[model samples]
Target chain A: MCTYATVHADMDGSAKGPGSEWFHVTAATVYFDHPVHAMAEHTLNIDLADAAKGPNGRVALELRADSARALIKAIQDALDSVPEELRV
Target chain B: MSEQLTARTIQITGANGDEIQAYLATPDETDEPGPRGAVLVIHHMPGYDRASKEIVRRFAELGYDAICPNLYWREAPGAAPDDAAAVARAQGGVPDERLLGDAAGAIAYLRALPTSNGKVGVIGYCSGGRQSVLVACNLDVDAAVDCYGAFVTGTPPEGSLRTNLVDQLPNLRAPLLGMFGKDDKYPSPEHVAELDDILTANGKPHDFHSYDDAGHAFFSVDRPSYRVAAANDGWAKIAAFYGEHLATTASTPTGA
Candidate 1:
């Protein structure tokens, strides 16, 4: 269906990008659309990127809907396990 | 049979006269007489990747000069195709006006070639499919092919950036060949039927074929959605349609 809906978030973090080099990530673009490599017809895709570093400066993931939801829960659980004071 | 052809990347004028990257393919010059028709291959929303380039070459092998403009060049120049697509998608995708402009540029480039027969056809897959119809309605194209394009007759989800071309259908200026999969949800059976009715009522020439056992992207060989039978038959339809509309005749004049 090539869903055109996309959600963008500004972020301050670092991730391993092309060439296995770590780059400061400035934004996250999330969408449920056709995947480049995934076997499924559609998947939840996330691209963590550093715009200033050009296109190659991206860390990408394509997960099934269920996998994406599970990942979200996992992230929330990991954050919750930290002390309130340590959460930031 | 494989035809001798040459393919390369070149820069062409796009929307606002911006120089953007494009892939161009043409059959090798031989003793073959008369100029050849041209085709504008619109890449899907996935951006101008290798598959899209291969499609352009396929048209060339079919003896048509073909070109595919990089729709994301303005946003992510020098970027890998997938990266460029991600960047473009985040930006709400390419605007309709900009798409029309870039298509016009590509068509112009094809027509300007010395070997062109001044006839141009357009073919697009996925999102490009809808754009193909949009371009046909707004431009002076000879033929158009829409391969399972969504939102051409159906409503997109709420807050989605996509829109249908119901109003534009009345202005369709070329013969259209639509290939769809009955199992596909987007542009489902009902939507395709609706489109068929509108074009019929409008007196627009259209040939639509819906495959029973296929779904969306049946023509995408690299994807799991690919349906060999549907894809092969769709290709045959495309070739026949273009042959009828784009073939050079003795009475036809060359040049843009």
Candidate 2:
């Protein structure tokens, strides 16, 4: 399983709305690079409010399904796999 | 002190049956004649009180209506209790959902009010600084000003006084103007740089200023953290930013 949080920021590339007035997110799509059964039941719960915090601060480490723990560890390890030179 | 708009306090329902007490102040232009703009002043986690209303009074002097909301609606009541317990209780309780929900309610309230010119904007300092950002993100506002507030970053510090504001940047939409002091311990220069990088990478329209002599919250001239020169400069720039954006909407002179 693969899953990480994402921020639904200004689509117009502006920190705020232009003529529209309010800034809001209609939907958010989470990313997970891991493999799960095609038919496996999966759900993701996210706090849209925390997306501004970036990686560690933005999202917490919890699972959505039966193997959530395993999924989180797998994704985190993949992130930790960067070579020192390629870490950039 | 200049003339101010008569303020009204009303109890409004928030997310999940929460009762939020909101303060609305508008420029009493009906008596003075001529129409001015309106400003939505979101208060910090400190909650609405005398200090917060005075801020609204200052905005009224600037020839605009200002409304402030008590975002701490869900927090346990009996504020302060005693003077000696102030420092301890300030750290007691503030849930993320509670504050955000209350702010959302406040935004709705401002939009429905008759006295408002409808060209609304939001600004806050410290905890309120980030709150302003959140309100701007989720609601429609002309402008947003964040002063020495929390910014989202890579790592979390252990002693962080606030957590939710740190994670809400991606939802941002309002044209943001951030003012920070080099000495602000919470948001160090590096933190500001990281935020700059992300915002620039995302191609967000943002302007950020940091002063070396000033540290965290130089806005309050009466406080210990206040710096005369930096505060004045930041204040003027903020005023200019609001004047450029919030003060003018579709109906105003240059708004068209």
Candidate 3:
């Protein structure tokens, strides 16, 4: 068994509609050949608010790492599926 | 026609008689004008032993006092022979905690510099990237940029690097922007989105941009995975974001 799973990863779009129109995360080119070189996992947290006459406010993220590589295919598939709009 | 930039250092006493050294880069005092803002740049696991001053030098070009502190100074030479060796030092060790704490102190130290305008920002790569968010979460600085940092996922959390960054994302008083590569193996897109979701949900003013074609450390020119296009775009975005949020404007009361 692959022992992996797939996720939206916001490739389809973080908040919806076209991919290009949404924010995107790139790939791990350094670890493809050696999945173990880049394996890691952690959760991200953010707080929303109103400021400077702006609708959105500050956001923060927390990450935790184990070794280097965790699951490869799941992350790759999400990248390949991102909408054309999100592609760099 | 580029003027010669100056390089200098400062000695900081960490615990256990360890003397921490920092690398500082300043624009030519001969320049016709002063800097726009001041920024402290932190390097990744490769240490100050790797990479160029040009990245931080570019900050000086933008008219800001720039400093890149080497957090690894506490270690003896040749300590981390490889990535794993460095990882061992970074995960759950006194050096790691002290380095991070020192980073916070560096922020304060810069804020006090005679050249400082009280407005400051921080930028980091890889481990340094993770630290940028961590520092901003715990401080009252102007802004921060986290480039392709490792993120957390799942209920229990998976990272053992021992950084509390992922958990503190919701508490940043200043706007933080994170850039990641979608194809990155360590920090998957799912994880990146989880971060975005948390920020959006909390009403935090943050934006995470993951380049579709780029990968981990894509901005790192010295690495094999460096993506020219992505790095260029990222640099522009970061600069603009800082200009909007951190830089001082004639109309704004104080520029951060």
Candidate 4:
């Protein structure tokens, strides 16, 4: 089923995308919906994009529900391991 | 019918008279003696990709001129299907008015074809299913098919702009054929029941079939959700439904 629900965020970051080039991504769109290429029926999809650079300037990920949750915890743990001043 | 058909991307005036790309398919001239009924195939939320175009070609092989307008053209023109879909999704999806206008334009384009029999129907999968029903309610289509579309009988979740189409039920202007999977939860069995009840109350003409042991996107061949048994039967039912309601000899009904 198409979740038809989306969660959006504004962020400032650079990510390697198409053509192995790096581009500044300004927005993140997250949703749990049907995967475009994943083998699973549904997955948690995330797209970090720069709208001004057009559709090609983006990175996409489709991870299973469990994997996505694990990723969240891993991200939190990595940040926690860093010193407060160095984290910034 | 022969498998010989031609399909190509063509520009058509769509929502707000914008020239948007669309895939149009027509059967070989030798297969049919004269004009044939047309079908406006609406692609799923996955965007207008190869799978949807294959469906359009299938309709042509089945003896109908079929066209699928790229609903995401205005969002990310010339972008890949997945890319365009992402842009459209981030933009809160296509507005209801824009879709309505696009469908209307596609219908007109089909009707104006020299070999058109002046009869047109609409069929859609996933989100397109709900949009198919929406067009039937607001346009002059002769037939409408909804394949496992959600948000038709139940409300969209909070924060989503899509609303239930129950109020628009009374405005339906064509015969509707709905196919659903009993195992699907979005348009669950309960939701299908509710839709049946409302269509009955509105005195609309409809035929609904729910397949057992299947779920949403059962017709999507590329996905693991594809159920061959259910999809085969659903296709047969769709062909017959269009034959009954969208045949050239079928009587035209007054539009709302």
TM-score for predicted model 2 compared with the true structure: 0.63
**Candidate with best DockQ:** 4
Error of 2 at B252 (Å): 7.7
Candidate number with greatest lDDT: 1
Q: Is candidate 3 or candidate 4 better by DockQ?
A: 4
Candidate 3 CAPRI classification by DockQ: incorrect
Q: What Cα-based lDDT does every candidate model obtain?
A: 0.92, 0.57, 0.57, 0.90
- The alpha-carbon lDDT assigned to residue B178 of candidate 2 equals 87
Q: Score the docking of each candidate (DockQ).
A: 0.75, 0.01, 0.02, 0.81
Tens-digit lDDT track of model 4 for B35-121? 678899999998998889989998888888899999999999999999999999999998889999999889989988887878899
In candidate 3, what are the lDDT values of residues B22-117, reduced to their tens digit? Answer: 667666666714435678787765456446366777777666677776565544332322332232232332244665567766666666665565
Model 1's chain B yields a TM-score of 0.97
TM-scores computed on chain B for all candidates:
0.97, 0.80, 0.83, 0.96
The window of 10 residues in a row where model 3 chain B has the poorest summed lDDT is B81-90
Give one digit per residue, the lDDT tens place, for model 4 in A9-87. 9999899999999999899999999898999988999999999999777899999999999999999999899988897
Report residue B192 deviation for candidate 2 (angstroms).
Answer: 1.0
Off by over 4 Å in 1: none
